[model samples]
Target: MGLLLKEVEVLVVGGGNAGFSAAISAAESGAKRVMLIDACPEHWAGGNSYFTAGAFRTVYHGLDGLLPIVNNVDKAMVKKIDMKAYTADDFTQDIHRICSGRSDPELSQILVHESNAAVKWLAKHGVRFQLPFNRQAYEVDGRFKFWGGLSLKTQDGGKGLIEDLRRAANTLGIHVVFSTAAKRLGVDARIGSVRSVFVQTADGIEQEIRATAVILAAGGFEANSRMRAQYLGPNWDLAKVRGTPYNTGTCLEMAIRDASAKQAGNWSGCHSVAWDAHAPPHEGDRLISNEFTKSGYPLGLMVNTEGDRFVDEGVDLRNYTYAIFGKAILAQPGHTAFQVWDSQMIPWLRDEEYREGRVERIIASSLSGLAQKCAKHGLTNPGKFVETIAEYNEAAVAFQRENPSKKWDPGVRDGLSTQSKTKRLSLAKSNWAVPLIKGPFMAVKVTCGVTFTFGGLAVDPKTAGVISSTSNSVIPGLYCAGEMLGGLFYGNYPGGSGLTSGSVFGRRAGKAAAAASKTWNEDIQLLSRL
Candidate 1:
């Protein structure tokens, strides 16, 4: 027998935003004690939430709507900002549009309804809020205009959000253990109810932690290449992870085996994006993990290693199309692609992920010169690459003469979607299609990076209980949240919905699990008497 730990009323696995939210909500709901565990070491405890930009999607009626959920900002700052209303319909439509209409309607309803509540809850706890200055706004006549429903961000980036969650958890007296991995999830022999968790402690001791209920808030299996190869097929093993390496899907696997967890959603699908090809395999370094990810695909054109365009670069706004573009890159030879842009579109480029004139880049003065630079950087058929850009530019010019065009604007609509400015090409650049003229161009290489698996165990919408497909019944005393619980998203997801889904479901899961724990205890007592 290994070490036996004291029992707790609720046990939450994972220490990221979802985990912290569940633990805090459970404690507030009167769980006698709540124990939260993280597989990573102390400093790296936030999981994927730490590695993100920390944008949240909430429905708001312009600036006045934000006033209820937003705080900690100066009145002068608020007065200067102009925002557009992002109603529930807009949020719902956007979700289904990107998800290809496969997102669970029940879960989507919860996400949209409680979106504001989730933001306000975290803000009430410990998180600070400010209008996202850099990512969500553009300067208009010297004043900042905020667009997108994703205007409010944590005081800092992803790091600050998780830090605030951790601070709140500590203040509420929730017990958190880092560097602890769950080895087993114990279920009742006869009742088929989860009761305890067995964990490998940081010090190498196997500890049995008895709890009234367990919430699998850990995350998806994005970091496990073997699992990726198994679910997403052969070439996916080559995909880079955009977040934590510790999210190896241990808790999800253990629950599936020990309990009859019904898997749902797209097993082969995930939320992937074009990340820096030079970034490390598992995102080990924090300094460069998120910073090096270039999101300026709209400002230029993407060419595969074969020096050919795979998809229409301007088919949609970067916000709407970026998540799905990584797979196109993955499909390319060598699982790589390059983005090329010229001086004409320089001002519209993002300032976040790159240092101007730095990082790995091939700069040139002419189309052929750029092709030569591409050849040096391991691209094949450099001439074809230059030809593609020239063709694209010619089409852009022709389209502009025939159709009305709008200058690319960002702030008024939080970087709203762009429309085709030129005649539709075979792969038409729909929006923000600027001709790549005036040389002094550059290219940065990239590839597919998986963020989270879009598939996991299905949960009951009302109670957050794992729903058994075998019997269509609840797995008693077992609950789930975060990436481990599925049926919310399918092939693709809108920007900023992942974090919001986690928080909304995490809150519900914790409250439901705590209440169910009491029911389980009473059932046991009644059975003993019988």
Candidate 2:
């Protein structure tokens, strides 16, 4: 005979940020028995959240200059972003515009309304955060005034948050198991309700976990190349760069295999920022931080295979990233777009800590030395590359001179969608207005990369219950949140929204699941009596 199964009021799959918040919310929502499971040995370590700069854009009372600029959205929902700018209406409109009207309006409303509550809940659990005193240049309207996002300080920051949630869960008598992997989800055949979860323990023993409600918070499949190729087809190469090494999409696979789950949203091969992982300076090359979206000296200048500048140099890094990615797609398979900079930019890169440890002095010595460095990196012909730098410097000097008022604004306004007019003009010109006439330029190849695939299973707004698009019915007790749920974000991703979405939806899923568990229990009792 088969062994008897364990039982719980709620079962949460995956222990990343979404899973962590969901587990805690479920326990707090009055689930008598809750069990959270993760495949990681201890807890998830170094997931994408830890790598994030931890910026959150909100409309609150005190903050003024850190939120995104939302020009209009009378019909859209908006909320507190900061004190000075971005009212609730503005926030909702900005998000809705990004969504392009396809997102579930109910979920969007919940996200806007519950985001602050989620922040409060996180703070109550001991997550530390600071208000935005200064907004990044890209956040033109300052929505992030009153409340800012939290940054984790721990060996494994992602795991640290999970640990914090675990403690909160423990205090509420919730059960958490590490080194346990769910093998398959149990679903009732008649109504397609999730019946239980089957998992393999560390000792290689199979066990069944019965739950009245189940939440599948399993993350995106960025790490699974096979799935990426299958789902994305020609764009499979975009998934080569792994967002989280452990996110192999096993649960996503299981969901797709079952008849209950359906796909949502279209795949947008969003552009990604690049860092030379192998030859970075001492700190380890990541994205250039200090020089990002600020001044001109360390600004990014993208060039095509023929060493010609493309796109506006002064565009926001995130938006500029997409343009550069387009250039990469046009380049020969092995030849991608490259960023060329001078030795003078190294100090800014080093100070920001984003450049890792490489310094400007070390990057360039004399004209000849820079050329040799380029040759070593296989960027271009040493002599040709050096000459290109000198030419660019001359042009830069000339360009600056032609514009008498160098401090003049670029005149960007809302609804200006033309790409040609957005091209960056020179900030400083030479005596007679020439281009770059200096030497010792450095070049690094860049390719189009992706962080995570945003497409996945569809879910309802409030309950986060998994739904079948064909049948237009909810799989009674199944739920999903975080990167696992698609259609929440489409076409573009606004800053600070990813983490907020996960927290907001995860909590809703947990609370709704806990309530469903009780309803299921009562239904069973009534049936028994009948």
Candidate 3:
């Protein structure tokens, strides 16, 4: 069965972090009858956020500044930790640096300047950020030090993030319609604005929900195979998806068709990771989606099926470089790569990789034994594998001998050279290239798993209004945010910027829509009649 609301003051599409933020902001801004519509059913309704660690990258003044975000942390305990403050300049520089200065200037600027404010807003609305777990911090001399410009993790990770956002929406009495998919948007030609959307209900009935304004925060088109093949180029459809299957970009398509929107950002660029090769094609099991990611590549060596090393795994931190490596793996012969680690490196693997006993890994006590194990699983013969390891080990030994005093620093590249050795690899391992001489080596196979798409309808930065390509102006009564609003990132992206961007722009778009729709009553009576 379907139910139609005669006239909604605002219609925010999607139900993930962005959509929830938009609805909460609209209702807070005094918009009446604000409703959020999502295509997903209630249980699996947080979109991609449901499967994330909810790491938010922001600017803070060391430990004192971090106190606000990590409210649950005891001040006494925080004082014992050595925290480095990431300045606004540091944040922006990283945004530019990681993407090779290809990210949009204005969007990156806003994200840097307004990131703190956005986090504060989320906190005000009951989003609690807990002290980071094992990933971004390390203890030295009995004092914990934070690294990689990341210090806070959401209290409940992604699920908790969604719950807190939705709880805030409910407290504000924001209406949410689940299991309803937006089919098409109806535009008033005279005003050049979206007035209503035709939605298909859960029971397959068509319903129209007229609204004063529409905020599209329904995420990107990464889930649609044909769209992925068309926009992301050939073989992209073959890559595994790491998040929701519901984000087909239908809202983005409709917005572009009606709003004269220009596409922006690197459409082919995405936040991809080196997920487990044996994992399902899509987000099948929550446990697999959560713990299946094998991110210990920088700590060891990864080789394609040709038994050859390709990328310099230690050029940058895993978070900064992980997004692009998946594409490299996708380009490999079998679209697969193996992350090989020795006994010494095994202790350094991420906690999830160690805790999750389900990972199908090859284990052995010696290089030759490990080679035999890998050969059994189709990574080429044992001889070639051992030869490759010996060469890699020689380079690592030479580098170690040259820099005898150097220590393993995960925060920045230590310039650990794999070039000065007797055998030089074609593609260099610039940093963290130590000898894999320890016994009991282990390896995990990985393939490309895309997180989200980077391209969508371009918008005005200040108002987050969907921009008109023809007039170079905002489309009245139309707004877009979250992953659907592009022009923010390119070439590559910062590790934890997705959720922060979504919240910042989603809140802005919501408040903008509420203020813009204050006088929009022209079609209320007409929409009511229909």
Question: Candidates' lDDT values, in order?
Answer: 0.80, 0.56, 0.82
- Sorted on TM-score, best first, the list reads 3, 1, 2
For TM-score, the strongest prediction is: 3
TM-score of 3: 0.95
- Deviation (Å) of 413 in candidate 3: 2.4
Q: Which sequence of candidate numbers ranks them by lDDT, best first? A: 3, 1, 2
Q: In candidate 2, what residue range of length 10 has the lowest lDDT sum?
A: 410-419
Clashes of 3: 0
Per-model C-alpha RMSD: 3.0, 7.8, 2.7
Task: Return the lDDT, model 1, position 178.
Answer: 81
Model 2, 1-530: lDDT tens digits are: 11223998999887766887787888888888888887656634324554444444444433322212221212221353323344556557756766566666776677777766676677576554443223233222533222112211222333344455556766776676776777888878888788888888778999889999888877777666676667655555442342455566788777766645888865543323343323222121123321221122224355544445444454332321231343233343343445655544433232342343432222455656755664555445556555655555555544445543543221122211112222233332212122322444445555444445678788888688888756888888889988888876665555566667777888989999999988888988999999
Say which candidate scores most in lDDT. Answer: 3
Q: How accurate locally is residue 54 in candidate 3, as Cα lDDT from 0 to 100?
A: 87
lDDT of 1 at 434: 70
Give one clash count per candidate, in the order shown.
5, 49, 0
Model 1 segments more than 4 A misplaced? 1-5, 68-73, 356-358, 410-424, 520-530
Alpha carbon deviation, residue 185, candidate 1 (Å)? 1.2
* Model 2: CA > 4 A from native: 1-5, 43-47, 64-84, 96-106, 131-163, 233-242, 268-271, 279-298, 304-306, 310-313, 317-337, 343-347, 350-362, 365-371, 381-399, 406-449
